[model samples]
Target: MAFYLVTGGAGFIGSHIVEKLVRRKEKVRILDNFSTGKRENIAPFLEKIELIEGDIRDSGTVTKAVKGVDYILHQAALPSVPRSIKDPVTTNEVNVLGTLNILMAAKELGVKKVVYASSSSVYGETPQLPKMEDMQPSPLSPYALSKL
Candidate 1:
């Protein structure tokens, strides 16, 4: 089985990813601060995965989590536009700086791939219904801009 590290694996989307990975019998490790993630989300499969309760912004924690991992699925972030507006500093610290930490760890550890979960809001408001990836991003909020 392949070993995987899933940051924010206790959150909504991240929890689902953990579920799928566990079902496949992959060895999975979770690193979540639980700022936004709930304990109940991961309660069902606690024994199946390794849990590391920590923040992504901490380089030491991130570096430790990335060790011996085949892939890094970076899903940790402080989400929501309104929340970002209310506290841009916290949002930037978690989203931007946290992501930087993940990238740095993955690069230093020689991990082959890092799958980052970027918000679709990066596409911004446009007349185009099906927001194409090629389109230039025009972020409307601090959260959207950080995702870009």
Candidate 2:
């Protein structure tokens, strides 16, 4: 049986992804700190998922959670620009360092592709209408720079 691990699977978009994976008849697990994610989001499909309530910045916790997972979806992040601006330390701890923890765990466990979520605020104050992937960034906020 193939196993899938979704970090921050209790959040809005992460919950949707976890629901789809569960519907597809795949073995799935979740890692969430519950800092921003709401419990109600995943309450409907609790049976199918093994929820691990822990911070992603903790490598030991993350590493332990990565076992027996064939695929990984890293959706955990400090997504709000305003929050990132006001409290960048926690934002970086969760968004950047936590993402790094996921990457390290994935690499060590030999898991397949890991899709990590990123904020669009990296687009900065550029007047460019349609933002492409490769744009010279001009970040106006700390959150924007962090994402960049």
Candidate 3:
């Protein structure tokens, strides 16, 4: 069984990912600070997976989470646009620096893969339908910039 680490595994999207992994009987581990994540989201399978309650901004915590993991599903972030505008510093620290911590830890520990969840807001408000990856990213908000 491949060891999978889902960061922010208590959040909406993260919880769903955890549920899928659990259904597949994979060895799952969760790293979540629970700042915006709810306990009830992951309550069903709490005992089935290893849980580490910590912030991703801390390198030590990130390293601990990534160690011995095969694939990293990075979903942790301050995902609010208005909140990022209000507090860009914390947003950058959590979204940018926190992601950097995950990347560095994954590389150092020889993890096979690191799957990142990026926001579509990076494209900004374009009238064009069906956003393509090649389009120029015009991030308007601090949150979008951080995701980019």
Candidate 4:
């Protein structure tokens, strides 16, 4: 079975991903700090996967989490515009630096793929009704900028 690592696997989206992977009988591993993620989200399949409680900002923890993993589904982030405006440093550290850490670890470990979950807020205040990837990103808040 292909091993999969889902960062922030205890969060809403991440938990759903984990459930799908588990239902497919894939070998799944979860890395979550639980700062914003809730335990109940993954409670249904808690026994089916390996859970690592740690922050992505810590390289050591990230390395440990990525070791021996084949694919990485990166979903960890501090989401909020007002909160990021209040504390941009923490947002950058978690969203940007934490992502860097995951990439570095994935590279060193020879992981096959890394799927990043970015926010639509990166589009900022585009006048267009529908946001397309072709459009240039106009991040307004620190949270959006960090995701970009």
Cα lDDT of model 2 by residue, 1-148, tens digit = 6899999999999999999998998898999989889999999999878999999999999998898799898888877888877898988888788888888989999998888676667777777778887877677776676666
The lDDT of each candidate is 0.93, 0.86, 0.97, 0.96
Pairs that clash in candidate 1: none
lDDT against true structure, model 1: 0.93
For residues 8-91, what per-residue lDDT tens digits would candidate 4 score against the true structure? 999999999999999999999999999989999999999999999999999999999999999999999998899999999999
Q: In what order do the candidates fall by TM-score, top score first?
A: 3, 4, 1, 2
Q: How many steric overlaps does candidate 3 have? A: 0
**Model 2 local distance difference test score:** 0.86
Instruction: Look at candidate 1 and tell me the lDDT of residue 38.
Output: 91
Which regions of candidate 4 deviate over 4 angstroms? none
- For lDDT, candidate 2 versus 4, the one ahead is 4
lDDT of model 4, residue 62 = 99
Q: After superposing candidate 2, which stretches have Cα over 4 Å from the reference?
A: 127-130
Q: Name the regions of candidate 1 deviating beyond 4 angstroms.
A: none
Candidate 3 per-residue C-alpha lDDT over 1-148 given as tens digits, one digit per residue, 9 for 90 to 100: 8999999999999999999999999999999999999999999999999999999999999999999999999999999999999999999999999999999999999999999998889999998889888989999999999988
Q: Which ten residues in a row have the lowest lDDT in candidate 3?
A: 126-135
Q: 147, model 3: CA deviation in Å?
A: 0.5
Cα lDDT for residue 87, model 3?
100
Off by over 4 Å in 3: none
Please write out the lDDT profile of model 1 over residues 41-146, one tens digit for every residue: 9999999999999999999999999999999888899989999999999999999999999999999999889998988798777788788778889898899989
Better of 3 and 4 by lDDT: 3
* Total residue pair clashes for candidate 2: 0
